[model samples]
Target: MNFVKRAGTSLRARKARTVVLSGIFVVICTLLLGGFLLQAAAARQEADARRTIGVDVTVRGKGLGPAVADRLGRSAPVNRYNPVLPLKAEARGAQPLESDGPKPPGTRTGDRARHFLAVSGVRDSSMLLPFSYGSARITAGRGITPEDSGGQVAVVERRLAERNSLKVGDTVRVRSADHRRTVPLTIVGVFRDPTPDPPRWTPSHELPGNTLYTPVRVAQELGSDAAAVLSEAVFRIGSPEQAERLHAEAERLLGAGTFDFRVNDRAYRDQVRPIQQVGTFAGLIVWVIALAGALILALIVMLQVRERRDELGVLLAMGEKKRKLIGQHLVEVAAVALPAVAVAALAGQLAGQELGDALLDHRQGDVTPGQRQREPVAAGTPRAAVGPPAMDIGPVVLGKVAGIGLGISLVSTAVPGIGILRLHPRSILTHNE
Candidate 1:
């Protein structure tokens, strides 16, 4: 009889053993599949975290103009950059929002009467820390973008806008503190600032509600010189690990002592670390589960071979080749493995998502909201998914599970069955009796 046909007959004849073996294989395969799914999810989550809370390198120094900042931004590590020039300007026609706090000692009635607004010039207002982190948001029109580099456009706070009856398309005039330069900025956007006023007295320009954003060149034009200069430049990189590469680029461009490059990765550390830890843990789980599953299946197969010694001895006496005996055992185990893989794939999908959510929630809870927001976020970047990493069973994961399952089948059947089938037929039959 053909070995394949005999193997099928043997499995049917020992229905109880086949069922038990299939059950064991199902459990092992489920665990192995779960581990593989988790590893894939962790890797995906880590990549998303890196993209969301990218590293921000702030460069502050003298003469850091748009040209210089643009050069630094062109570096391979930089994804995007924003250069800011901060100024305090007297509101020409609009009212500057005042803090609700009580006046401090030595308060000047004249100072209180003066309307000043905090103005910031930027390549892209949307990339500002306040706007990027959700602390402040544009409520109307559009933010100051790169194309508005030289235009006299502004995006003012909504309160400041309401105070002055300002809206998009309206013009707001601001005079440089020196009073020598007054410029009219076309209001292209209005933003909302949720920051509360200081407990004590604060200047009108320093009030959160009185802030304004404009084009970088507009700010420089209002400064002492016609030359463009920046208060500071912030460059964003994909991950904290890329900070070093960015630093090297900065050092090379600025010649090392000309500027101070500071890397702020607090947000990255707080948010991404949890996902990284999960990835590492998942890797360990995959290895442990694979080894343990293989060992368990190997022992079960060994016991099964021992219990069927008489059957194997008779087959050997009937002139069945030793290799065919082993092949028959391998075929039976492989047949069970195929169904076990299918069942495991189904079970893993249902369980893997819950397991992924549980692991992510547990790890993510370690970072508080305050801690996660401590560092400045890169503006205009899409935020990562707020919940658990999506667990998916793709072809790669299925392939890995299938490969490992085959390995387990081979180890479980070949090793122990080979040793038992090596014994002489007479010795095997007498020993069983």
Candidate 2:
């Protein structure tokens, strides 16, 4: 008989068995596909987040000064590192006095005022992040060049510029505690800072605003007492294990007297805690369901063989080869089952994509409340100083999902087929009698 005829006859004779097996295949495929796709997506998202956030080990010491930062910078194990000293200065500018001032004698039309706080002079290795809070884009200017160090040039945040009504090429005055000096900073670039919500003791806004960038040397020049030593160090290691080892080694060498710092691995782990938990749970569920599916399919196929014993005996008696008989049975079951599995897998992928999106959206929204509370509101306004988080999904992530889903389908199907092949037609036929 032709392969199609044999497959059709076998399935028609065992309608109930075919339907049952198909149902099992569908469940197995769905579970496997959904689990793999979601896990892969979660892993990709976690990795991307880690890269964007970066991993850094900060080394600081009360007595170590900036020299320690410089020393660690030369370490071969270090991927990239920069040292910085936090300095405070006042930026003075003239604002047009309100018209009421014109009535007063000797009242200058432009008044000078001072705004104080902290700034930093960081090494070339340390630069502003390219994107933060979507708002921190380079609009209308170049960023601070390495040469700007020790020069009178500064790069201020766009929000800061708008609030102060300052633009590129404007001259502003910066004052150290002991002396007052005016610096003419050409607006080379404006960038948004993607600092996390709630200012965490960093100089810039919790997200990216009201910040300024200038050459490290220029910062030092503004503050004569400014020490040239590095304050913080960032390193990119080959692996998590290497990062851990390097962190420990650096800490040991510096001793407790040096600054306290953290590794990127720790931050990365903490960031993906939720996704990791979800992945673990999904994995467990898939395994349990797939196991049950394999068991059910095997049992259904075995039982169907028993009910077909008379027919199998006749086929054998008619000179039908045992191997052909087995092939026919295999083909019959596979033909019905594989298509069901494929359909279920497609459905599962769609479901997983929707679920993943919802989970991400919910997580992002949940953080908004805490972010608003921690955001620095400009004086006299309830407006949040924080900007929206950056959420960009690239092609690499989609490719990962597709690969994982295909892998799951092959493994889940092949595993059960092995047992199916080992079935003996003669023994099954004899038992049926």
Best candidate (score: lDDT): 1
Off-target runs (Cα >4 Å) in candidate 2 are 2-5, 12-16, 53-56, 62-82, 88-118, 122-152, 155-165, 173-183, 187-213, 223-227, 231-243, 248-259, 262-270, 358-362, 365-433
Q: Count residue pairs with overlapping backbones in model 1.
A: 0
What TM-score, computed on C-alpha atoms, does each candidate reach? 0.85, 0.61
Model 1, span 185-250: residue lDDT tens = 999999888988778778888788888898878787676666656888988787877888877877
Q: Model 1 segments beyond 4 Å from truth?
A: 89-116, 132-134, 145-152, 174-184, 194-204, 362-387
For candidate 2, write residues 1-433 as lDDT tens digits. Answer: 7645887887887798777767766666666666666666666665544443334555655644555655565565565455556565665663211222122455343322223434566554123223211224566565554455456666666656776777777765666645665555565565545443342322221223445666666666667565555455555442355565665666666775356665544433444465567667667766776566555655665666656667666666666766666566557656765576557656754576676665533243222221111111232211212222222233443333334333443444354445444545576566765
lDDT of 1 at 44: 76
- All models: lDDT? 0.79, 0.52
Judge candidate 2 at residue 352 and give its lDDT. Answer: 61
